[model samples]
Target: MKIIIGSLNPTKVGAVKKVFNQYKVEGLNVPSNVSNQPLTDQETMQGAINRAYNARIAGESEIGIGLEGGVIIENDRLFLCNWGALVYENEVILASGAKILLPSEFINELRNGTELSVLMEQYTNEKDIRSKEGAVGVFTNGRITRTEIFEHICELLFGQYEFKKRKEENN
Candidate 1:
């Protein structure tokens, strides 16, 4: 199986590779066609779906994977949200990963139009934070990494696909 990942970010690519180890995975840099900083769940999910569809079409692969990270405000608190999508043929499978409430410091910066990756870099004093541990890693103190988050999402997506396939076969 040939799988194309929408983003060249190491974490996103690594998650797809890890989840679908038997497949040939290619990471392509594709635009998500959404805002740099998605402020709602709907926008975040759309970004993932767009990337997955675009990558699959561009790579001419059997499957495409997209992972998007965004922030959402709930009850006057900001939370980090991540979404992933798997596109195959005309079907799309979606899943959401863990959500963590961001500290006021991060939220303040995010409200000022700073992207999460930028805020992470500033908070961790590290360059290219997205390629590394990412915001989840920083907040979780390495207990959970961005790759792990996306991996879980992929697992859920794959599970859903398998379940649907099996149901169809049974029917």
Candidate 2:
């Protein structure tokens, strides 16, 4: 089957590749149509959905995968969140990664309307932290990478798709 991943970001592409290695996969820069730093879980997931649908149509492929990272608030505390989606034919599967709580200082910065990527870049004195180890990797002390976070989500997407197929066939 042909697979397309939405986003030219190396980490997102790498995450999908780890799961769909047996298939013909292509990575294309597709618009998510969401803010660069999505502020809520819903918007983040919407980005993933939009990317997946757009990529599938753009590549004329059987499957499309999208991954997105964002920040969310729970009980007035900001946390890092990521979401992923897989689209196939008339079906779509969605999965989310673990949420890592942000430090209070970063939360304050975000509340002041700074984008997460920009804040992270300044914090680490690094460039393109969003496309690299990511906030998850830094916050997690390099134990879990951005790629691994989305990789697990991609695995969940395929697992859900397979489970749905089996259920339909059995029915």
Candidate 3:
């Protein structure tokens, strides 16, 4: 089956291709325009929907993916929410990675209006914050690999799709 990932982003491309490869699904990466501003969780989800919906209108594909990030509050702490929206033709599938946990005190500081990227940069103090090919970035220092995190997101998406398919078959 043909799967169209909504963005030409290298990270997203790497993530999707890695996960879908195991399923034997042929995945395609299409160029998509993502907004510059960071999205809220709800807005992030909406962004995914927008991307997938637009992709469907653009052409025929078995699946489409939209990856987005947002900040969410829980127990007075702010967390980084990175997720992917997987659309299977007419059906919409949702999947999310585990939230990158933040310290409560730091979350409070961010809540006071500090950007997480800046905070992360200042905390590391090595510059090039997005670099995941090393011991920096969100998924480094032996914590998590970028590929593994994205794979989790993809797993949730495909797993949900499989669940639905099974449900439908049973009925």
Candidate 4:
């Protein structure tokens, strides 16, 4: 099986490779067609779906994966959100990772129009933080790296596909 990922970011690409070890996987830059910082779950999921389909079309592969990280405010508290999508032909499956409340300091910066990636880089003083451990890694203190987070979501997405396939076969 051939799999294509929407973003060339190491974190995302690494997650796909780790999850679909049996498949040939490649990552390419693809547009999400969403805000730099998606503030809602709907926008975040749409971004993932968009990237999945676009990457499938671009790579001409059997499966395409898209991972998107965003933030949402609930009860005036900001939470880190990550979503993943898998695209096969006209079908799509999605799964989201655990959400954690972000620090108030980071929320202030996010409210000030700074993207999460930019805020993370500034907070960590590391260039290309997204390519490495990402905000998930920082918040979890490396307990759960970004690649692992996305890999879990990818597994969930693929599991859903497998369940659907089995159901269809039984029917």
Clashes of each: 0, 0, 0, 0
Go through the candidates in order and give each one's C-alpha lDDT: 0.89, 0.90, 0.63, 0.89
Clashing pairs in 3: none
- lDDT for 72 in candidate 4 is 93
TM-score of 2: 0.94
lDDT score at residue 113, model 3, on the 0-100 scale = 66
TM-score, cand. 1 vs. native:
0.94
lDDT of 1 by residue, 1-171 (tens): 899999999999999899888889999999999989988888899999999999999999999888999989777788889999999978999999989888766666776788988877777789997888888888899999989999999899889878988998999
- After superposition, the stretches of candidate 2 with alpha carbons farther than 4 Å from their true spots are 111-113
| Residue 69 in model 1: lDDT | 90
Model 4: per-residue lDDT, tens digit, 14-117?
A: 98888888889999999999988988888899999989998999999999888999999777788888999999967899999999888767776777789999
- Model 4 Cα shift for residue 111 (angstroms): 3.3
Candidate 2 contains a number of clashing pairs equal to 0
State the lDDT of candidate 3 residue by residue for 22-87, as single tens digits: 543333444335443243567566767666655555547667777665567777766666667877
56: Cα error in model 4, Å: 0.7
User: For model 4, how big is the CA root-mean-square deviation?
Assistant: 1.3
Q: Is candidate 2 or candidate 4 better by lDDT?
A: 2
- lDDT per residue (tens digit) for residues 52-134 in model 2: 99999999999988898999977878899999999998988999999989876776767677899898888899999879999
Task: Estimate TM-scores for all models.
Answer: 0.94, 0.94, 0.69, 0.94
- What's the lDDT for residue 20 in model 1? 89
Q: Worst lDDT window (10 residues) for model 3?
A: 128-137
